[model samples]
Target: MKLTFWGAARTTTGSFHLLETRGKRIALDCGLFQGRRSEFFERNRDFPCPPADVHATLLSHAHIDHCGNLPNFVAQGFEGNVFGTNATMDLARTLLLDSAYIQEKDTQFVNKIRARKDEPPVNPLYTVEDVEPCLDLFVEIGYYRTFCFAEGFCGRFIEAGHILGSAQVQLDVEQASGAQHRLVFSGDIGRAGRDILRDPEIPGEAQTLIMECTYGNRPTEPIEGLREELRDLVTRVADRGGKIIIPAFSVGRTQDLVYQLSLLFREGALPQIPIYVDSPLSANVTEIFRNHPECFDRETRDLLRKEHNPFGFETLTYIRDVEESKALNELKEPAVIISASGMCEAGRILHHLRNSIHDPKNCVLIVGFQAEHTLGRRIVEKRPKVRIFGEEHPLRAEVKVLNGFSAHADRDELRDYAFRVQTRSGGMLERIFLVHGEKEAGEDLASYLREALGVEVHFPERGDTFEL
Candidate 1:
């Protein structure tokens, strides 16, 4: 068998990996790369391999960075079954359609500016028309059920604990020489004790492991302190009659924040202030979350049994119509508004940031990883000015980041997970490959694994390929 690093290879955004065996190719993920605009378009618009040649595609989760480019892949002529868990298939349906809509909208926005500057208009990577066919190719596989891709190949999906329907893939291959091997792909490992989702399932055994190291260099704040920190921030903003604007991802991060806030409100720890989820995509994704109680953790399931609707309350409102979303800008009272496109790059979050970021009384909260060169990074860096929708905006809002809300596992947790896999495999886990992280993060984790776990690790670059 052969493996190729197509994306997320020394960087965190695009996550494509190609595996070849028995004259056929399989892609683990085909995610959109997010970064500098020119590079993002060039990378996401094209696939390194001919899409038609691929036999199958297995999706790990529905996050845009992991499953965002499926439409583009299918548009390029790949005609194979896309396998995922039932929840993953359902969530991916919404996420991919939303992604396509965003692409078309963002392209129109950029084209208008380009036309004004006498530059050629760029095309959207994929559109809603392209997403429908991709959805038709989706096939649902239940967790722990093994499915055959070819005569000598089969795999199982283990609970990954990152988001609803996320899974760690385990592939078993039978070589022509009658030798057998197990390969595991750790798709965005989640925190063990994070709220709402269960802890990552233990990877039973494997010979070769490909894992993500998104937080390899950063240690998260104590989980116990997350609620108190959030409560204090919200309380301060409300006391000053100011808005709290949060840039969160629609899938996991947004739901996590809503769940935490619900807990605080139920316990009377937080003041009664109106809370709005401003993105239509988030509202849709939350509905998907409601349908998948099997994905919930013990705590969340308990809450669901009692409250029936853990994501709703008297003060909580989900904004779907554009008029309602725009009305949020007109409100003068204190409120907490959570918006999507977490990097502050797109969606209603841009409008919310533009309207509220200039006020010293207002606060902007960042609750997820901010890749380099993103608007979120600029805010985290406390830049004096930021450009939104091609206009300069003052950055006077108090910018606060809480690392405790992150879904990815930190350095120590990753090390522990690797050790557990190693121990469980009884030294059969010979090769470990780290992907889905920045250069520094991959390097740091590589050193830690080499020194602490004494495992042979490799950090593959984009376009790098290895035969095993």
Candidate 2:
């Protein structure tokens, strides 16, 4: 089999890896490349492997970075079955469409500025029409179900406690010599025992193991402690009669915020302020979480059995229509509005921030990890001023970055999962390639995996391939 690292070699956004055997191809994940506008636009707009030759696509989860570029793949000539869990499919239905629309709108916004200066207009990577055709390829399977692709390759998806339906994929390939080779791709390893999702399942054993190390260099403090900090911040903002604007990702971060808000409401920690979820995609994604109660941990399951919906509390409203979404800015009352595009790159979040950033009384709650050079990162750094829609506005609102809400496994958690894989498979795990992290973080994680787990580590460059 031939395996290639096409994306997420030294950074986390785009996640693509290709495996080929028996004259057939299997791509692990087709995710968007998010960074600078021009770079991201060019990278995600095309497929590394000609979509025509690919046999099948296995999606790890439904987050944009992991599943965003699938529509673009379909827009190209790819027409194979897309594999994922039921929740991943559900998320894909909304997430991919939303991503396509964002791409269209973002490109239009950029081209509008260029047009003002007599520059040529840019085209969208894909459109809603492209997304409709892409959704036709989705094939949703359940956990532990063995899915066969091509003639001699079979793979299974186990829960990777990262999000509602994230999975760690294990592949079993049979060569012509009648010997089986095992491989595993840890897709954004999640926390060991997190809320609302079962802990990650062990994927038997493997000779070659590929894992993610997003937070591999940093130790994660317990998320349980963050409630107090969040409560304090919300209370202060409410008392000041200002709105709380939270820019979170539509899939994971949005759900986590709603769960935490439910807890705050139950404990009477937060004031009775109206809450609005402005992204339609998030509203749909939340419903997907509701449908997959089987994925919940025991505590969350028990809570659900008791008729306690942990994601929904009193005083919360989901706004979807354009008119309704715009109306949120008109209300001067103390409220919490959660919008998508976590890093303030696009989506309704920009409108929310543009409306509220100038008010000193408001609080901008940043709950997700922001990359470098993003507007969200600037806010996290508490920049005195920020530009939006070609205008500079004073960053008067207070910014509180809550790191506890991360989905990716931290340093210790990554090591724990790595060792657990070693314990399961009786064979010696050869090499562990760390992906989906910055250069320094990937290097640090590679060092830790070698030292702590006694596994040889390799950080491959883009287009690097290992013949197994």
Candidate 3:
């Protein structure tokens, strides 16, 4: 079997991998590459190999970075089954459509500037029309149910605990010579004791491992005191009569914050200020989360058993209408506004940052990892000035990052996961390929894993390939 690193190789975004064996080519994850505008367009628009040549696509989750480019891939002629968990398919329906809308709107805005410069108009990567065909190709598979999609290829999905339906993919490939191989792909491994979802499951046995190393360098703060920290931050900002603007992903992170806030409010530990979820996609995704109780953790499931909605509270409102989203800017009282595009590269969060970032009394709460070159990273770095909508704005808002709420596993957790996987393999594991991390993170992880596991660990780069 031949494996190629196509994307998310030494980077935290765009998770695409190609596996070729038994005269069939399969895609691991066809994700959109998120980065600078020029690189983003060129990378996502072009495929290393013909999309039509790929027999099937195995999706990890509904996060845009992991499954965002499926529409474009299908539009480019990939007519094959897109396999994912039932909840993943449902979440992807909402996420992919939102991605298409963003693509069209962003292209239109970019083309307006090009028209003034006499440059040719650019087209969107893909549209809502393109997304429909892709959704039709999705085949829902339940967790741990093994199935064969092509000749000589069979796979199963294990609970990844990252999001509502995130999973780690394990594939068994039989070659023409009748030799079999087990390959496990750790699809964004999640923390063990998280709030909403179950802990990541370890694959039973594997010879080759393809894993993520998103937080390979450092450990995150424990989940224990996170609620108290959030309450303190919110209380401080509200007491100062300033809005606490939170840039969170629409899916996992937003729901996590809401759940925690619900607990705090129930205990009367937080201020009685109004809270708002300002993205339509977040509201829709939250509803999807409610429908997937099988994916919830024991605590969340018990909460639901009591007929309590953890995502909703009396003081909180979900805004969907454009006018209602706009009205947030006119609020005179202190409030908590949680918006989407967690990286602050797009969405209503940009507008919130542009407005509130100039006020020192306000606070910008960052609740997830921010990729390089993103506005969220700039805010985290406390840049003096940041550009939003082609205009520079002073970044005076107090920036507070709460990494405890991250869904991705930290360094210690990742080490423990690798150890468990290796142990489960019964010393038969051959090699480990690390992806979904930056250069330093991958290097740090490679060094640590080599010393601990005493195995061949390679941090592959884009276009790097190896034969097994």
Candidate 4:
């Protein structure tokens, strides 16, 4: 079998991997590459190999970075099945449509500037019309139910605990020579004791392991006592009569914050301050979350059993209308506004940042990882000035990073996960390849895994290939 690292090789975004065996080529994850504008367009538009040549794609989750480019992939002539969990399929329908809308709008805005410069207009990667055909190709499978997706490969999805329907992929491949191999892909491993989803499940055994190292070198703060911290922070900002702007992902992080806030409010630990979720996609995704109780953790399920809505509260309002979103700018009272495009690359969060970032009394709360070159990263770095909508704005808002809320596993948790996998493999594991991380993070993880597991570890770069 031959495996190639197409995307997310040494970076955190765009997770595409190609596996060739038994005269069939399969894609692991077809994700959009997120980065600088020029690189982003070129990388996402051009595939390393012809999309039509791929027989199938196994999706890990509904996050844009993991499954965002499926519409483009299908539009490029991939006619094979797209496999994912039921909730993943449902979430992808909403996310991909939203992504297409963003693409069209962003291209229109970019073309306006290029037209003034006499440059030729460029098209969006994919349009809303491109999404329907892709959506029709999805085949949903329940967790742990193994099924053959191609001639020689049978795969299963294990609970990944990352998002509502996230999963770890396990493939059992039979070569033409009648020899069998087991390959496990750790698809964005999540923390063990999170409140919303179940802990990541470990596959029994596998010879080849492809894992993520997003937080390989960084240790995240514990989730314990984060409620009190949030309460204190909110109280401080409210006392100052300043708004607290939070840039969160629409799917997982936003729901997490809402649930925590609900708990705080129920306990009467937080002051009564109005909170607004200012993204239409988030409102839809939250409804999807409500429908999928099988994906919820024990605590969340128990809460639901009591007829309590952990995602809703009296003071919290979900805004869907553009006019309502615009009216938020007119509010003078202190409030909490949670908006999406978590990296602040796009969406209503940009407008919120542009309007409130200049006020020192306000706070910008970062609840997720920010990739390099993104506005969220600049805010985390506390850059003096940031450009929003082609205009520079002073970044004076107090920036706070709450790592405790991160869904990805930390350094110690990753090590423990690797150790468990090795132990389950019963010393038959051959090699480990680290992907979905930056250079330093992958290096740190490689060194630690080698010393700890006494096994071969490789950090593959983009387009690197290996035969097994």
Candidate 5:
């Protein structure tokens, strides 16, 4: 069998790998490359391989960087089965539609600018029409259950704990003589015992492994520290009679916020104030989470045991409609409103920030990873002013970050997981290919693995291949 690192090899976005075995081909992930518009658009709009020739697709999760290009694959004439867990399918149902909407809207916006510049208008990479066919191709694989695709290959989806339905993929290949080979691909791993998600399921053993190292150079703040910090913010905002706005990712971070708020409210740590979830996608995702009780950790289950609702409380309101969401701006009293698009890039959160930022009393509590050049990072840096909708506004609102709420595993956590795997497998994972991170992070994780586990780690470049 041969494996090719097509995307996310030298960069952090677009996650994809091509696997060839026994006269057939399988794709591990089909994701969009996210970066500068022109570069990102061109890279994602084209496939390195013939899309129609692929036999199957094994999805890790529904994050755009991981599963974003499935529709494009369909658009390019791939009709193979795409596999993920039930929760992945649920999240993809929301994420793919949202992505399609963005793609169409982006094309329209870009075309208008092109018309002004006297340049030819370009078409969207894919649209709702493309998303529909891709949705039809999804076949949900239950966690831990093996499913056969083409000859010489069988795979199972393991819980990755990054978000609802995130998974690590393992493939088993057998020949006619009954000799077997195993490969494990660690999808973006999350911290254990976070919110409603189950712990990342550990792979017992495998001959080869591919892993992610997103936070390889940093150690996350303790979860208890985050809880205390949030409590303090709540007490401060309530005492001052001011509102707090949180811009977080809709999938994992939003759910964590609700669950933690419920926990704090239960412990008498929160004051009586309104909490509004302003994203319709988050509200829908929350419903999907409620449907998967089996994914809950003990702490989340314990909270549910008494309160009967781990993600809901008396003060919480989920706003879905445009009018209802607009009405939130009329709120004059102290409250907390959580919105999506984490980066404060393009969302209703911008409106909230614009309205509340000039007032020193209002707080913008940031609780997710802010990429470089994003508005969220600028807020964290306390830039004097930031541009919003082509206008610059003063940055008077207090910006506080709670790093403990991060979904990805930090360096220490990744090392611990690596050692745990090392001990269990008796050094079976001799070669580890690190992907889905910046070059420095990949290099740092490689050194750590070599120093601690005495294993050879390779940081493959884009289009790099290995024979095993």
Candidate 6:
């Protein structure tokens, strides 16, 4: 078998990997690369391998960075099944269409400027029309159920606990010599004992393991402190009649905040401030969350059993109409507004930040990873001024970043997971390929794994390939 690190290698985002076994090629993920505009366009505009030659794609979850580029792949002539959990397929439909819309809107915005300057107009990576074909290819498989995609190949999905329908992918291949090898890919392992989702399943034995090291260099703050900190921040902003703007991803992070806030309001810890989820994508994703009760953790299921909708309450409103979203800025009273595009990239979050950041009493709460050069990172750094809608605005709003609400496992947790997999493998785990992290985080995990378990770890650079 041949394994190739095509996309996410030394950097986070753009999680594409390739596997060739038994004369068949499989694409692991066709995720969009997020970064500088030019690199993002060039990398996602084309596939490293020929699309038609790939027999199938095995998706891990519906996160944009992991599944956003599938449409482009399909548009490029890939006619193969994209297999994932049932919920993943459903969420992917919503998220991929949203991603396509964003790409089209952003490209139009850029092209308008380019037209004035007499520069070449750029096209979107893919359009909504491209999304349907990709959705048609999705094959929903239940967790722990084994299926064969081709002759001499079989695969199964394990609960990953990252988000709804997240799974760890296991693939087995039988060679012409009748020898078999097992390969496991950890798709962004989630933190154990977190709210909403179940704990990540213990990985079984495998001859080769590909895992993410997104939070390998740091330990997450305790979850208990998250609610208290949020309450204090909300109270401070509300006391002064200001809004709290949260730029969250529409799918996982938005749902998480809603559930946590529902708990707070239920306990009377938070005031009766109107909480508006002001993103159309968020409203749709929240509905999907409700539709998939099977993905909920025990605590969330318990809350549901007690006649409470964990994602909703009397004080919460999901705003889908653009006019309704715009009306939120007119209100002078204190409220909590959660918007989409978690990194403060392109979305309604930009409008919310523009309107609220100039107010001294307003608070901009960041609750997710902010990639370098992103507006969210700038806000997290407390920059004096930020550019919104191509205009500069003073950043007088208080800024608060909470890491405890992150879904990814932290340093110690990742180490423990690796150790457990090693022990369960009983020394059969031959090679560990660490991906989905920056250079520093990947290096840190490599050193830790080498020193702790005496395992051979490889931090393959992008485009590097190896024979297994």
Q: Rate the local accuracy (lDDT) of all candidates.
A: 0.89, 0.85, 0.91, 0.91, 0.83, 0.87
TM-score of 2: 0.95
TM-score per prediction, in order, is 0.97, 0.95, 0.98, 0.98, 0.90, 0.96
* Model 5: pairs clashing at backbone N, Cα or C within 3 Å: none
Error of 3 at 434 (Å): 0.5
**Residue-wise lDDT of candidate 4 within 144-245, one digit each (tens)?**
999997777999999999999999999999987889999999889999889989999887688999999999999999989888999999999999999999
Listing every candidate in turn, what is its Cα RMSD in Å to the true structure after a full C-alpha superposition?
1.4, 1.9, 1.3, 1.3, 2.8, 1.7
Candidate achieving higher TM-score, 3 or 6: 3
Candidate 2 lDDT: 0.85
lDDT of 3 at 32: 85
Q: Write the per-residue lDDT of candidate 6 for residues 23-142, one digit (tens) a residue.
A: 789988788888766687788876767899999999989888899999988888899999999889999999999888877877787788678889898888889998988888999998
Better of 3 and 5 by lDDT: 3
lDDT of 2 by residue, 110-213 (tens): 78878898988878777888899888899999989998877788988899998888898888998666678889998987776567888887776788889997
lDDT tens string, model 1, 1-468?
899998899988889999987788889977888887769878987777899999989988888888888888888899999998889999999988888887788788878977898989888778899999999999999999999977788989999999999999999988767689899999999988888888898786799999999998878887888999999999999999899999999889888898889889988999889999987887678788878888888988998788667777778999888899999999899999999898987788888998999999999999999988788999999999998877789999999999899888988888889999999999798889999999899999999898887878999999998888
Over the full model, what C-alpha lDDT does candidate 4 score relative to the true structure? 0.91
The clash count for each model shown is 0, 0, 0, 0, 0, 0
Better of 3 and 6 by lDDT: 3
Per-residue accuracy of model 5 over 124-241 as CA lDDT, tens digit each: 7778888898998999888899998877789999889998889999999774456777888888899986767888877867777888888877898876667778889988987998
User: Candidate 2: which stretches are off by over 4 Å?
Assistant: 176-178
Candidate 1 lDDT score at position 462: 92
